[model samples]
Target chain A: MKKHNFNSGPSILPQEVLQQASEAVLDFNGIGLSILEIGHRTSWFVEVINEARALVKELMQLGEDYDVLFLQGGATTQFMQVPLNLLDKDAAAAYCVNGIWGDKAVKEAKIFGNVNVVSSTKDKNHSYIQKDFSVPSDNVYLHYTSNNTVEGTQWHTTPNTNLPLIADMSSDIFSRPVDFSKHSLIYAGAQKNAGAAGVTIVVVKKDILGKTNRNISPIMDYRKHIEADALLNTPPVFAVYVSILTLRWIKKEGGLVEMEKRAKERADLLYSTLDSLPVFAPIVAKKDRSLMNATFTTHNKELENLFLEECKQQGMIGVKGHRSVGGLRVSMYNAMPISSVQALVDLMIDFNRRNG
Target chain B: MKKHNFNSGPSILPQEVLQQASEAVLDFNGIGLSILEIGHRTSWFVEVINEARALVKELMQLGEDYDVLFLQGGATTQFMQVPLNLLDKDAAAAYCVNGIWGDKAVKEAKIFGNVNVVSSTKDKNHSYIQKDFSVPSDNVYLHYTSNNTVEGTQWHTTPNTNLPLIADMSSDIFSRPVDFSKHSLIYAGAQKNAGAAGVTIVVVKKDILGKTNRNISPIMDYRKHIEADALLNTPPVFAVYVSILTLRWIKKEGGLVEMEKRAKERADLLYSTLDSLPVFAPIVAKKDRSLMNATFTTHNKELENLFLEECKQQGMIGVKGHRSVGGLRVSMYNAMPISSVQALVDLMIDFNRRNG
Candidate 1:
């Protein structure tokens, strides 16, 4: 049986990327040393990071003003770093809390500076992208999650904001083409669509940093990382190498344009199947549905375990929803094949036939 | 020709460990999905982290009061975090500045609290560990780098102090058996003696936390990571897995005792050769020489380039000196075999004979 991996983050990656990554561990570029043993300052790894950074810019269509950084610590670390580097002690940053990640971001931001909760969907159990929000008059930036993995909601378009925008694109980045130039800073944990777990990719406009008056630690400071060319300290070498392989795969497979096509096809196929079945119900507002993760449940709650048991029997890994939200979740990242989604739909339909 | 890699820090790893790490990237534990795609919260990864943590305690001969965490970012992040967690704004921490890393650590520590420069070898260009100093009664902790990779100086004995000791054993952590209970906290970048580059091993005593009246960010707080069991966020999954593999190799090869024995053999072989040849001069005080790194240069300044050229021809990699202070440094971390050090010794003798 073909296994369909639907892990939310630290999610699926291309097969070729995994292959190359594994080989590099044994012998990196035939340099007679494992990539693990290679020095970060060596030309071999310098080229690896350089190419990875270049590919990110090329794929995002960003200009020279933007600098790409591969830093350690995940997007969770960025939640505080964003405000620490960009938000001053007296300033307030506008935030839209649509899901778990958004709520966490708000909490972290509040510790660093003033946070204005412009919009929140927690009232509705975060099943919709809260679009109605008034940005504060003196906001430093309007921060929002571009895609909510746990909530199964995504902003179809960029938020309408003139302030320097900060987006946590951890789950849904690189799945579609957006005018990436509009945002002052964009951060994503490489575990999702970007690459592997461990490293984080930050695309930031250089001028937005150093504006805050507070003393930020060197590792937490974005300007320090930018000045060091992301080599401020020993970076996550293997993680960055894997990211390079992933970026190369993305470019070779026709960039974000092709990725969007695949994402839409997978989401559409699964959502349509849920709608067709009378026994199944899809969660989240249809207008705000995520093309990356589709959340759904059966009307009879007791059948959830049986449905999951069937999923397990067929070699579907990590299809269970997050513990906080108990339901089935089918995550379809850029690397997820349509066949994987179709397999889940088949399991769901067969489950309905037996249980309904 | 077989390659002898002596890259400091992100240096060599066991061949068997590298093989296992490479295999896991393809299919982890014979599971259908790549290790890169596995969720951090899964039982598989949880088991891995648990075992790795347990191994750190067991190897160090520490008790339950100590907690181990595999963190992202390198030892650099720990420099500021050590003070942020332990040092209050009104308090002071004692520091020993021996080399580049120690100087950086002091600079970061001063940001959070007053730093008492109890000892320093900077006057002597950091060639020897300045042991003669007094620990202030008002100091919170005594901090020092157990081994300085750049200056090739190491503390032959742990610094004498009643203050809670904090050591950055980044380069030479697993190479010797220390009285681990002496230090309240120990942090090492996993690139050297632990496993890979991305993860950092932090063995911290549980009771030392919560002393500071600071609102530390959840990610930077050691207590928070201990509470979360090192899964505070999506950890560098692949990096931790590599660490586990390396730990397993260390345990199988007789743990720290065997590691120390091999380290002594390599260091003695290289130092004796350097002492025998007048053309090749070893740096650092005779007693202060590092068992993990041997720093030296030819007496003739003009022959330095020629010696490096001959080293390269003999397939010696990363034998070049630190860019800041020029001279060759051969770092023989736990993973470096005795054979590799002998090869370098042979090459040095050949160069000396030709140049003499």
Candidate 2:
């Protein structure tokens, strides 16, 4: 079966990227050496790291003020690290808890310093991003998840915060261009829109560092990683390599502008199909809907099961929603082909007609 | 060119494992979906995690007493985590500082609690593991690195300690079977003997968790990970899957006993060849020589360069020594074929004949 993958993360990558990545695993850069076997400190591997960092900056339009770092651990580690490296033990960091990912960030930040949850839609069951949060003036920084893969909510616009804004853009980074100048730091786990898992890319404005007085471990210290150029230790070489491939793919496919256009189209098709279907109901408020993950549900459980079964039979994979939010979710990340969305829409329409 | 890879970590995997991993990235387990595209929470991926976990336990001959975990952030994260989860803020942890990795472990542990340097070979430039270390009586646990990839030192035998023993076998795990009952915890970054980068396999005694008074991040808490079956967050699915393939390869090639036998043969050939070469000198004490990484150097820089250049020309990759310890390092890891070591030996012999 020709599967159409809709996994939220550790998610789909470009076929070309997969092919190229696989070849590198066997023989990286025609060196007859598997990427897994290359010394990270070697000139060739260093070039791979440098090129990948450069591509991220180029794609994100980040300037010299921003230092792009490929660190180990995932966005979860950054949850604590951001606070550990930024917030003083006595100070507090403002967090907007819009969904599960945001909730996690807030939870992790609390471990290091005081966490002021400025706004939360947890009361609303995380149905949408809270747009009217009053930013705490005294807080170290404002933290928010760009897109909620589980709740299927996304911030349509940047939060108005004078503080250094830190965004966990794990689910929606690079899907569209944003003002990199507006935020002090942006982190994304590569499993989503980037390339692969294992690496967390943090683009930090260098000046934002060295404020926290806590004794941070070298691995957890953003300054240490930035100074070492993300080679403080042996990095996730293959993950970084694949990310570069994905970045190149993004560039070849016309960068974020084109990516945004395609993402909007895919989300529109899927949402419109859901809205039109009597059996299926879109979960999140349409205005705050995520361009990356589309969460929905059918009125009938049997029909929902049948729809998922039929979708799988029709070569659609990972359409099942998170257990926390038990429903169907189609994560149309940057690598997700629009045709895959169309196929899902067609299947939904047919299923609604047959079962309704 | 046929490259003979001897990288310390992010090291070479079996060619067949690489081939399988590459194919799976395009299409996993005949699911018609790329492995990279699958949701980790899905039953399909959950099975991969379980199987990988099960394989580790099986390989180690570990019973239910040990809980296997697949974690991110590598052993560096674990350095702090092990103390954060196990050590009370008032307690001390004993550390045997044999090499750079052991020193790093001690440094990271100091952040959480007092770290007692039980013994150290720093006086001798970490040339060998100090066999006469006294375990601190008041320490909560004793920590050591089983094999030093950089310093090229290996513990010929496990240190006797009354306290809970923790080993960072990052470079040597699964190369051979150790007495797991002797240690309360053993953690390894999966780039060397196991499989690839991004994932850290930690086998911890279940009872030792939740003793610390410190507020630990959920990701840093080993019990939380074990409770979640190592799916605390989205895992590096591709890395885990490749590790599973590598584990299967190890099993098919007759398990750890066979691996140890092959490792000994390869290391013996390389070490003996280095010893016989009048121009070159092996760095580590013969009794403490690493069965995984063979480090050597020459008195003459020109001769060293010539040997390295000749080896590179003859398809030996990653032979350059670590910059911190400048020389030549031939890391004959578990997946390294003995024939490759023979080829390396032959190259060294030919080079010596010309240079001598």
Candidate 3:
């Protein structure tokens, strides 16, 4: 039976990408050396990394003004690195804490400098986006998460800010098109939409660096990373290779425009099923609901357990909700086929029919 | 023809390990989801990571007093983190600079607190280890590299120190038995002896943490990593999984004792060949020579180029010396077979017969 996967990050990847990545692991480009053993500085790997970086620029429609870096330590590290490189001792950065990830980012940023919480939906347990907030003019940069993987709320529009904008697009980077011109830095942990678990992709405008009064550690320094072209040290080679194959797949599937279309179709189909059933209630507000991760719950515990067990028996996996937000979450990343969403919708319908 | 891989780090891995890792990438342990798509928090991955950590302790003969962590950002991150977590503003740390890596550790350590270079081999261009050094009693910790990858040198004996001992064993962790009781911490980049490029293995005494007065960043703090069991964030899941497989393979192949015997055999064979060939000269002193990487040179550039071209034609790879060294380096890490060293020796013999 074909399994329908909904794992949050380190989620579903396209079947073809998985096949190609496995093959590369065995014998990359017929070099007789497993990709696992090849040096990061080898010519073949250098090409693979460059192509991956180029694809990020092409898909985002960003020009040469932006620099792309493949780094280690995921989005969690970026929570500290962004503030380390950009914030001065006396200056402050603006952050909108709409969900768990945004709050975590704010916490990390405070260790470096003062952080202004411009907006927050914590009062409602992050069930909605706080959109009517001001971006402070005194801030050095405005940092926000484009989508909250836990709460299933997304920013429909970026904050209007004159200060340099930094966004952690960890969960929804290539799922839709965005105006890249407004952001000074955009970083995503590749496990969600891009590729694997090891590397983080950062798209940064080089001009915004070198302004911090604090001495940034060399490894965490954005200016040093930009100058070295992201090869200042041995990178995560196999992960970067996997991300490259994923970028190639993204290009073949008609880029972000097509991605947005499929995303809407999947989210609409699943959301409509929930709306039709009284047992299920969507967690986030309609305007702020995410197209990537769909969160919902049946307030009755016994019914929810039964629904989850039935879905599990029918080859559906990873539908259990985060413990903080107990219910259910179905993550439909870019590589998640629409057929999987259809399978999930069918399972939900069947469950509702037997218990409605 | 089967190629002999000798790239220094990210060098070679066992054939069966490669096959199993590739298969897991497709379908992990009969789970319908590919390993690439499995969440880090899933039960299967939890088992993989836990077993990997346990194996490190088992192989090192460490007890409950130590904490084993698999982290991201490689050993480069540890250079600063060791100082960040252990050093206070008033105290100084001691470092023995033997080669490029040890020097790098010292440089990063200086960023956090005062560093005392008790001894250095820089005057000899790192061709030998500086053994005559006194450990400063007041120092926070003593830092050194176990094996110098670029210079082809390894310390036969660790520095005698009453202070806490820290080692960058990036090239020689599993290749031999170590006095684990002597060191406060040991860290290795996985690309060399362990497995892949994305993850790092860290073993530290739990008592040494929480002593630093400086407020270390959560991601860079050892105490936080230990508390969270190295899942402080989404770890390098794929890299950690790969390391688990490699560790399993090491156990199957008779563990460290077998590794040491094979390492000695391969290094002795290659070094003997260099000794016999009038055209070649070994770079490092005999006592300090590395079993992992063997560095040598020919005075005539033309002869060196021809020998490399011949090796390439015969399916021998990664023998080119680092550009800074300007000669030849044959890295024989734990995974490199004795047969590969024999083949290299045979080629050198044939080349000398013709060119002499």
Please state how well chain A of candidate 3 matches the true chain A, as a TM-score: 0.98
- lDDT tens per residue, model 3, B1-356: 45799899788988888898898889998888888998988888889989999999999999999999998988988887888889887789999998888888888887778999998999988999988889778898889999999989999887788888999999998998888879999999999889989999999999988877786778878888888877888998888988998899888899999899999999989998998888888999999999998999986999999999988998889898886677899999888988889988999988888887
Give the fraction of true interface contacts kept by model 3.
Answer: 0.72
Clashes, model 2: 0
Angstrom error of the Cα, residue B211, model 2: value is 1.3
Candidate 2 Cα errors over 4 Å, as ranges: none
Q: Tens digits of per-residue lDDT for model 2 on A1-356? A: 76788888888899899889878877888888778777788888899899999999999887899999988778988888899899887998899988878888888888888999999898878987788868768988999888998999998898888999999999999999888789999999999989898888999999989987788887788888888988887788888988999999999999999999999999889899899889999999989999999888899788889888998788788888888878988898998888988888888878888888
The local lDDT score (0 to 100) that residue B349 gets in candidate 3 is: 88
Estimate, for each residue in A106-219, the C-alpha lDDT of model 3 and write its tens digit: 888888889999999999989988877787688899999999999999988977888899999999999999997789999999999999999999999988988878866788
The sequence of per-residue lDDT tens digits that candidate 1 reaches over residues A1-356 is 33799889888999889999999999988888899989999889899999999999999999999999999889999997899898887899999999899888998888888999999998889999878778976899999999999879999989998899999999998899999999999999999899999999999999887888887888778888888888999999999999999999999999999999999999989999999898788899999999998888887667888888888888888878888898988889989988888888888888778777
lDDT of 3: 0.89
Candidate 1: regions farther than 4 A off: none
Stretches > 4 Å off in candidate 3 = none
The candidate scoring highest on lDDT is 1
